[model samples]
Target: MSFASLLPAAVLFALSFRLAGAISAQTFAPPSKGPLVQTANYTSFSNNTLHNKHVVKGKVFDRIIQVWFENTDFATAISTPAFEQLTKQGLLLTNYNAVTHPSQPNYVSAIGGDFFGLQDDAMFHIPSNISTVVDLLEEKHISWATYQENMPENGYYGISYKAANYGNSSAKPYSYYVRKHNPLMVYDAVSQDPARLRNIRTFNDFANDVVNGTLPQWVFVTPNMVNDGHDTTIDYAASFLEYWLVPLLTDKRVNGDRTLILVTFDENETWEIQNNVFALALGGAVAKHLHGTTDDTLYTHYSSLSTVQANWCLGSLGRQDTNATVSNVFSFVAQKTGYKNVHVPANQAPQFNLSDVAPGPLNSDAYIPFAAPNLKARGAGGGPVFLRPGLNKTLTVEKLPPPVDLYSLKKAVPWQMSPRTTSGKNIIPCADSDCK
Candidate 1:
């Protein structure tokens, strides 16, 4: 008989506990939020919610939940009372910034690691040949989902959804949900898959998942326009946090089990500034010792992707996630993973305030065809980079030839239309199977 087989049951349990503790540094017995009320009507549209308790052990944390606000500058958000109060319970990220001005590109870049040079909040449909963090997460069998508030239905493709009777004034219809804010939907890689579309859920689904104790390993939460401060003030967004996030902070269903919750904004309202936005790291995964502390790592929206990649030891999208300067892993995760982060002196920090300056496949004025991932570039995860199918392996982003004329490329690629039409229509016509 093996020597290990002779151990007592209690001793084996203790040994297992120690090993688990080594993987997840901390655990919490958070208070429960009594039963939550489900108010949204889900009968009209498909509301397929996948309930998976599959736990993918990570080097630092098990699960990551991102809660994003909108367009509030750092100074304004930090000054808000509710925002200030939450900082006391979490780690405040001091130097975090958004990638660009306007909301859509930042949201897109957060998941896909690149915005493809998008500069506006107009509706865009990326080709299915492009892959996202979803592909990387799935490669490791890590469950992930996006919970959007006021999203009329699961994977609803409409440009926006206006509530029937809800608005500041009764005179105008209020569009609380916009497709631009739903990051994953912009990519055909996610939206085209029926199973993936089902995972794009509404707030009601989030409540149900929490109550049922079936929350996934990775989640992205986006509040509605008013609640996110896009069409309102930071005070309004703070109030929503108080009413929604404050109680949930202690709710074991939402915040426990080594789950790291990141509360951040998509971009700052002041385009003239450096796009610095207030961000906080909270939940059980954060060590109690680090609570109420501040981390001054130079992080951007792409850090979210890289941080997740590092946590789960997942592969890179080979986009900005591999950019050492901009997409540094979270300091806490980097410490555990031995990922060296670049330190940018404040004077030398890249100005992220400019929009529509860089050119890529999405920019009509300076169009470049979609290029494949850099197979040689490695991310914080240290896993083999993911190369999407149908991509020309020889046409890597680094080796791509000079930019082509927009008009000339448009003739060959009929689906390459600007996000907006001259008449202010946000919908780009569905020209191919890639577009919905």
Candidate 2:
């Protein structure tokens, strides 16, 4: 059915949805729900007509920055004073959601457009032949880069940094540059390609680029564990952004009317939380009047790709992104309005990063990062269990034993497969170790 046909119901429903607004940042409610502290309030906009309007033209934003944070639910994040204060400076998507649980698959889905049944944080490779948003950006001649904090070196391809200071790996104060949160590293094309490999740099590079006005057209930034609120609280991540990133948004070289910045988390606190995360859309590209407004559209991680694809008309990754919804708040941009269809090819399923690549240059250990968790998709087994103790019940990835007698939580079972192979078939951690 056409979106036009669905408008009346959606608008009426939006009227009853909670609306987020820019009130006095100094006065706010106490935190609730998760690790740190989070959006509801959608229909309270002073300008009620905005609900009826789909697109509004304004400045075009060619430069975009995406900052991804760790697991934090909306309720908890909203309680965070800084995150709440920051919401006033831009459009808040109250109903936004992450694509999946655990950090790896969501990050993968953000760039690759599909999850491919990823259930753990293991190191894995995507084939060089398969394309990502990186390919689309490059195809359109748009420059892009991925900057991560605390990485050992530029293009360093490891699952995580050795503890920031040895014992700092403790869950509450977790701190490190984990590869699982950095999506670009898993792309075989970027990792194996020399020139593209260098594009994945540390946050220091991002700092320098911002100072030098050398930021790329599309930039992906990830903070360390503590800074992203993974092993810490939302207050930690919010303070990091408030102090480090907020200033950059004012510098014309780093941000302005022609640029867009998104501060979003990878997933939610628990599966019972339904994968909701706090999301903010701000920048020169965002209409000024939209600063304190809220968009209630139910967007997911794929919307990240969809927004960029729509903004640049970059086509699609031939996956769910081809059909994923774009950020409706930015409907004002002319480029976003001009195109709708996302180009797709028939063979769009994820081709493992190790597909067809020789082990000589690429090994299973480095290419495939996480071990199978045998997590059940259903309540008894495979499905997510959000009602757990501690702050990061799901995102704190586990380390399974190696192939030589790998672990079986319930009973002994054997499963193995090469990560960097074209066939890419292996032992998936089924509920009963049922690989079939």
Best by TM-score: 1
TM-score versus the correct structure, for each prediction: 0.85, 0.64
lDDT of 1 by residue, 110-191 (tens): 9888988776655678888888999999999999899887788888987778764343224455577788889999888899
Candidate 2: tens digits of C-alpha lDDT, residues 1-436: 3212333564334322422322222211211121111101110111110011122222267778899888776666665667777777788876677866567778988887666545456566665654677777766567788877667567787666643243222323223667777888887768888878878876555555555556688889887766777765666677777756776776786776678888898887655435667888888777778887776665667777767766665556545565434222234442345533322232432222212222111222212322222223111011121221222223322442222212223222111222211123443343321111
Cα lDDT listed for each candidate = 0.77, 0.57
Q: Give candidate 2 regions above 4 Å deviation.
A: 1-59, 163-175, 324-330, 333-436
Residue 293, model 2, lDDT: 73
- What is the number of residue pairs that collide in model 2? 35
